[model samples]
Target: MSILIDGLLAILAIYLALQSLLAPRLSQSVFLFFAFGLALALAWVRLGAVDVAITEAAIAAGFLGVLFLDALRDFSSTISEKHNNTEAIQSSASRKKIKTFLLPRLAFGVGLGLFLLISLEAIWQIPQGGGLTAAAESMLPESGVEHPVTAVLLNFRAYDTWLEIGVILLGLLAIFVTGGIKIYTKPDVVAKDPLLRQVILFFTPVLFLFGAFLLYIGKSGPGGAFQAAVLWGAIGILLHLGGKPVFAMIPRWVGQLVLIMGLGFFLLMGFVFMSGGATLFEYPKAYAGTLILIVETLAAISIAAALTAIYANLNQMKEEPKENESAN
Candidate 1:
């Protein structure tokens, strides 16, 4: 029965991947991609890696899925509309070119297939996990965290996690510095829908509570900063959908502070430990859990804020000028 379930999940994931790749409309592709992420999460769970599954489901399916969906909506209104009329003219011209291009494409496809087969053969020849599993388990007791995964992420592999936080902050910087996105000066119109308002009200507090719970349990279980951050991001999206921007009332300096707090604090702690004659991020055994919690909490907040800002900015760009005018 277990093997059958795993086989079914693998097949479903493959189908979803193909659908996402071949879907003509951007919206359909985006949703199918999200579905693919969720299916992969289930596969991870079946393999007993709950932490990875949660991260995959939350960040991939939740955060990235919404981001793509919003971008697709924006694209349809801005660029796609302008090209709609010209598409027919382009189509006729493109068909003649496609016939001429088919032979080359078929040749390229055959080459790609051969390359992939060779890659898979090489991967199969590689040795399976041996050293890392034994090392992690042997070192787990001294890591100052109850869960091996948490200990690895917040302690043993701290540098990698720290860099990931920096990458997310960098992404927000890229979005803002680009200057193509505009913040809405007015409330969004979606909040006016009574049903939507009620739904947001109900879910908002639930997400907040759940996120905090995830953060608290992360040191001992599968929940962690990334999962919590994604939940907070969902909260931000709900607020935006309800016409309340995530940082609407936040002052600029304060907003910037919140955005940088996670990465800054993580770096500060690393340096602090380094100055005490230990290497960077080498917390004393007694203080390891405390330090990890502090870093994770602040990181979760920063991640949530950064993701919200990104979504709010992108969503603002999607609102039709007519909606703004009507709101006015």
Candidate 2:
């Protein structure tokens, strides 16, 4: 049964990948890429890697799909019939007149020789990263999570999680500091297309249920803070794009405080706990589970807010101010 499922999923993945590569419409290709991601997630699950399946599903199928759909909608006007039709003309001309590289023949020979030598060395080199059994075993007890990857993500490699949060927050800040904020309610942005509105309405409830399930299932298998939060963020972005939710701005102070609160809480908790000197962020073995839960909750909220704020700001930048025609 498992082998049959894996084989089917692998074939689906290949089909989606090929469709994505061949599709002429950019939006169509983007959606095919999303299908490719979903199929890859299924392949992971079939291979008994539930944790990787969930993470890939969240990052690729959920978050990335929403990003591409929204951005492609914005670019739809910029891509018109003239641009779409020019490819055929260019391809025919290119076939008729294939130009040689302007590089000197001697330099081309030297470059080809160097590339062959490097390719041979690369083929012969032994990869060092395949063995993680020792690291995984050492961290598993400290992780309190069943999946080794989740354990590493939330506990053993918590520092990477901390820095990734910072990177996301920094990206949000940079978007705002530039004129990239479109903080008004452009609720009709995607509603202008009824098909998208229908799609969003259909998927919103499913996403909410799935995201919550992922969060609840974290302790046992693959689902966890990052995956659940990303799913939530994708749902929010979709609803906002579909005219169901309006983008709004809060006071600068509130935004800044919320932005850092997760990291601050995490760092402070570590300081308090590690004072006994096992290591930084170390809780007593008895309390480790509870402490990790607290940290994950904060991390989830922080990531969701950071992503939603970016969506709000991007809309703010694109929106035109409307005059108040409200009743006097």
| Best candidate (score: TM-score) | 1
**TM-score of each prediction:** 0.88, 0.72
lDDT of each: 0.85, 0.73
Give residue 134's lDDT in candidate 1 (0 to 100). 86
Per-model tally of clashing residue pairs: 0, 7
lDDT per residue, candidate 2, 1-328, as tens digits? 6678777887888899988877767777888898889888888877778878878977786666666765674675444545645764566565443333223556888999999899989988967776987979887776776667666776777778778888888988897888545445657857898888889989888877887787767766778777877877777777777765523445667766766777888888878867767677656777767777778777776787788777666655434333323432
Evaluate model 2: give its lDDT: 0.73
lDDT tens string, model 1, 103-204? 677999999999999999999999875658888999988888888888888899999989988999888889877646465454557788898899889999
Relative to the true structure, candidate 1 reaches a TM of 0.88
Backbone clash pairs in model 2 (N, Cα, C under 3 Å; residues 3+ apart or in different chains), count: 7
